[model samples]
Target: MPLAALLERVSLTFRRQSVPAHSGVVTFDLGPATGYPLKLHLSTWQSDEPFRWESEADSVTIASGAFLEPPGIAWELLLATEGEALLQGMPVSVRKVIASAPFLGVELAQVCGQLQAARDLASTSPLLLILLVDRASATGMPQADFAEWLTQKQAVLCAAVDLPASKATAKLLSRCTLRPMIRRELLELKRCLNTPQGTALLRHHAPLCLEHFIFLSHYEGTYWPGLLPVVDGILENQRSQPGQSVWLHRQLADIEGMLGDDRQALRRVMSLEAFQRLHDRLLDHFNDQINQVGRAKLASELRVQYGGYPPAPIPGHEDILPITSWEALLQEGQRMGHCVGSYHKSVAAGRVAIYHLRAPEAVTIAISPQADGWVLREAKARFNEMPTGDAMRRIGQWMDQLTDT
Candidate 1:
């Protein structure tokens, strides 16, 4: 595919650069192009002393992976050129590394420097960093503020164990677990378990596995811990605790709803009339909108265009050609054989209007007057699958009430 098309589809930016010989470091700035930091390093060395090198081999490193955006075509291209450098007598390797989570247990600067070193080594992928905290470190800091601070970091997850439950620390743990993540990413940013007891607690509560599965099929081996039966001993034990069980049920219901398992979601939230009604309303609205748009194209009175060629209405409605002005709204309505009325309402921003079209039914439109043109906001009408001129005036009473408002 063309580069422009690829970039547009994947939301990626591409760039390339060369590192001169003897240069110690090379870095690229990819401001906001990436969600996570990317690091790439190139090193050159010579094993002069056969058995082992008496001194460390001289190397130049390229460190800037954090900036690489999606579908990293440029990075792959650059990495492929490593053989050219190797053939030049200097043994060289290109290392690609994923940056560590921004926040760590240790001093921030020192941790970053260590991560940078690891990225340059070409021995392993970027490491996952987990913070270890003792009672003092966990409690000495204001629990809520520290938790919030951790939450705001780019890629840090926290876990607190059997330590005396402070409200803030508990909140922090909740925040970490509740934050949505693909199973693989969740494992990557896996939070620290402060104590050995934390492990036992995790295993016991592990049955409460509510994961959102959007794109984990490829990484299922790494992310999918075997699924558990919905009603096993674990759920049965959880049922007595209303608060905990209710939250877990709701989470499961949400996942089911998102996965298009409406029947399952309804079973989970049967008592909550509002939940059922909300989902019903949403589905109904979607169906109505789809039907309306389909019918509109077949017998639409107004011809509109944001840009490009306006789509055809229908064979009989071909005369409904594109119009470019607010005046055309009424003219088109009349041509379509409807009683159209419009009035402007004054506002601080200038003037806005409500345009009414009385046909088989009445439609109301909200129009905002822009400097160069008018923009239609809320344009809606209850239209039928097929309509005729006489049917437009058949519901005169309803149309009159709609026009009055």
Candidate 2:
């Protein structure tokens, strides 16, 4: 109901103006707001002449089917102001282009541009997030040079697509280093895709998806066409592979044995072991079927699909961060609780530890550190449901380990 109510009205008109398409701003009654002069970064979809011209007509449809971000915003009006310059006769979805915001655009320039401004500069957010950039942009850094010479600490490099994005127009994606968009904002971005150009523009909004859902390195291979089946293949491979799921299963079994759930636990162990053998036998077949079909399915969508983990190694916990012992970790966590108590909470109240997963491919481990050793309470499975405390509880335990070691 809120969504329908929000899209109830959408119209655009054109007028002569010094600015280009911006002369055609659409205004909606999404209610009033505390106006903040957010200097937003935006891009547009160019339409053929008649549709563009009709867009400036006094009245047209702002269909509910179209998508917008900041969902209901009188703020969308700032992106456009109706003008008399009309091009063609078709509907245009005036989507707010999303980018690293607030501190993006001129705000960041001013701070980095001046020496005095740079001296007083600091960021307020925790876990300085980073901008996604091309491999070349990041590799340009010298081995010994610290990144602080570039931007704030909270700023991080968003992962890059292993493939070259554009024949030429790809730099925006390759060079983008920072943007702050929430789930709702992403929804808004997707909604705009219905217009002929909306889908193309929408992809520009979320290059991050290019990293996960895409392929890299080579083209021309056949592609897998379906999402669910690909998921099934990934699961099957995990079941069969000696690495990843296999390792986790072995670990889970030992814990189960400690807890006396031997039968079911043993069953899991055997199943994975069997799958691993089958996978090895069919390894050639699976790779052929999956890669050919998968690559084709994703080909047009992604510039280069990842083939056999490709050449570039991304920084993930290939190996866990080294710490001497769990006890040292706990002490460090307690110190964190003291320093940033408001942002963190200690679930270390007792012997019980619970790890709840927040998203796909991530796991939370719960533990309590002692003077020299530590205790494992509950380790949540990968990407289950994220209870509110799930992430923080897991991180706190991690912090405890860091401190203790």
Candidate 3:
């Protein structure tokens, strides 16, 4: 029998069976209008929790009595049914409703290619494209491939009338985060869709979207030259106050770090005068550390001699200091003929800053206050035996040992 004929004959209805709290059994009774037999298999599909399903004749009872059924299990069961035997042409209204459903794109992924190909005859090309994009988003792609797809999809969407506010685009943007793996793809999307008009649309739809923020922060000047102007334009156009834009400042600092000009990046985004004050504050902090350690020594002596309620408690030095830029230190090293490569902070929550220098070695610098001052509390280099010119220079200069001024 044709699937369409089978579906036309059967009617599905639900029945409640008694059970405990958060548990129940629902019977699906498929009544054949012609008063004949029907056979259906109840197999588990993708499940969030365990469930028992049994089928007899034209009826099935799905039990969640053992454990509570997940929120969408019933719905999944209906959709996951292997009814290729009963599957046929859906009503125009049903197809439209399914097309608009949030999970429709997700559902499309599980359907047999033959079923999809059959549907292609009935579904519009644009609708299929929309489904394809959504499927692509739900199941990720290679970074390079995803970027290219996003670029092309964005262009198609630009000219598309029916899918102006596409769910696919929404899902993609929402899923994008400041993660290393997806950073390139997100950046590509931003570059493709973030025109002046596009930015306006984005600002209107997603005013505080993190994707834009992440893209700006991770931007590599070496890879995307002259992109700062684009970022500056976006920030300037926004109604947000510059002073209160912590994300802007932080991301700009990050981009600057990538560009090997952290201070310059900070200056462009933040006030140069403010950074100068911060530099002075940093110097003062080191001076204070030196004074505190000396006083600690004196207090130790007093404990031995004229011990009196331990002299005014010295302030503990900050473990992580963001007061000064790393580029400043690197520039200082460069001035002294120490070849510096790209720098990276410890990915873990530690105050260890690592520098790659021409000396062909990784210079690990730890920041802390010692008895003397806020010096390079600890410095070590993991040198390569066969060093490059840059590494050889840095090794010979031995600039890893930058101490307190």
Candidate 4:
């Protein structure tokens, strides 16, 4: 059967029903006219609860879903399993039509029309056609210009499928215009395609992932052979972490912020472990210097302003002194090798108060206002280690005294 005729026979209807708790159900009806019609129902929630789905076909219902699978995999799985019986003898082009229906939305008919028109193009690979159709649908390129657009994108489209088929590849192809620099990077990625590191880079092409790849490309001559592996390691480590791109972007931005024009220093990073260690060391040094300067200024201002934190009631074994200025907090953190120095904002905002215990054993304490009164949020000794039992007891007694007063 011709691709267009096959698509005509394959009917699809999409409807989204909104309900309470910000939950919704999306249904896709495929080939309702065909005796063996398939219906896929997806139940989505605003909470962390997993998505649930039900697939009904030929009076049999298969219900299953996953928390970890990417957003559209459920629909694809339904089509591959139960819908396969209906699509048995259909051309792969027809199969792509059914698979892309839910995502293509209103553009399904237009995309199908464009696909039929472009069938005579040099490369009509099903994968390439679906990719172009997706891109066209997203960009709203008119049918008149689609042929020109397809011709222009022909080289990149062909090259994209040469790499692995993954969400990353789709994102890279659909979102990015193949500029000279990006094309160069793509070619280099293709060269390493067979290796584990190369395949990983292809698979995990998040925006920050691409930016990191481009950033490393600048130092390619210096880091060669090891650069891709470093990238792969970073991606692998970040894969399990949520908000991976956000985390990666912040880390990279910090490096750029700390080093500025010192590309020479960045060139020294040769491995993923080394990259992470450098980021840590740079962050610590940056925070320490900034905190020192900020604290000194804060202390000078606090001294002039005169109003100070309320004095802590000294117990028998220990003296609890309120940390009235950023300078004192910085000293506490520096001496303890902990992050109390970073609490300057919270202290200034009056959300929390800090104190230092001078006797029995030095401990830094944080107390926040609660419904009743101030409560100890944390008490830590040097290096954020747990304080001794006696030290905690003294602190607790001081808190009780403060509450009573």
Best by TM-score: 4
Candidate 3 regions with alpha-carbon error over 4 angstroms? 1-59, 63-405
Query: Candidate 2 — which residues are off by over 4 angstroms?
Result: 1-394, 397-405
Give the candidate order by descending TM-score: 4, 3, 1, 2
In model 2, the worst 10-residue window by lDDT is 48-57
> Candidate 2 local accuracy as lDDT?
0.29
Q: lDDT for every model? A: 0.31, 0.29, 0.35, 0.51
Q: Model 4 Cα displacement at 363 (Å)?
A: 17
TM-score of each: 0.21, 0.21, 0.22, 0.37
Residue 178, candidate 3: Cα error in Å is 16
Q: How close to the true structure is residue 256 of candidate 2, measured as C-alpha lDDT? A: 32
Which lDDT tens digits does candidate 3 get at residues 1-405?
Answer: 432254444544332222332332233334343255433232222222122344444353222221111222233335444322112334352343244432432233223121334234224333333334444445643334433443444435433322335554444343332222222443345453434434333434433344354444444332222233344444556624433234334333334444443344343333334433443444344335435655345334434543333211122222221312333333322332221212223212233333333223444333444464433323334321223455445433433333311
lDDT string for model 4 (1-405, tens) is 322243355443332322342334445564443345655555432223323455666656744333222223334443444342323333454444434334432233233433444443312433345545555554656666665555644555544336454544444434332222322454343444424444444344434334344444333123234445556666667563444433344345446656655756666776778877776676588567756677677556644654454343232333887875556766777787656665545566666778888768888888878876788867778755568889989898888887787
RMSD of each: 18.7, 21.7, 19.0, 15.6
User: For model 3, what is the alpha-carbon lDDT of residue 351?
Assistant: 31
Worst ten in a row by lDDT for model 1: 48-57
Candidate 2 on 283-374: residue-level lDDT in tens? 33433443465533433222232222111111113322322222322222232221111111232233323232333224444454565555
Global CA lDDT computed for model 4? 0.51
Q: List where candidate 4 sits over 4 angstroms from the true fold.
A: 1-82, 86-102, 105-131, 138-231, 256-263, 283-405
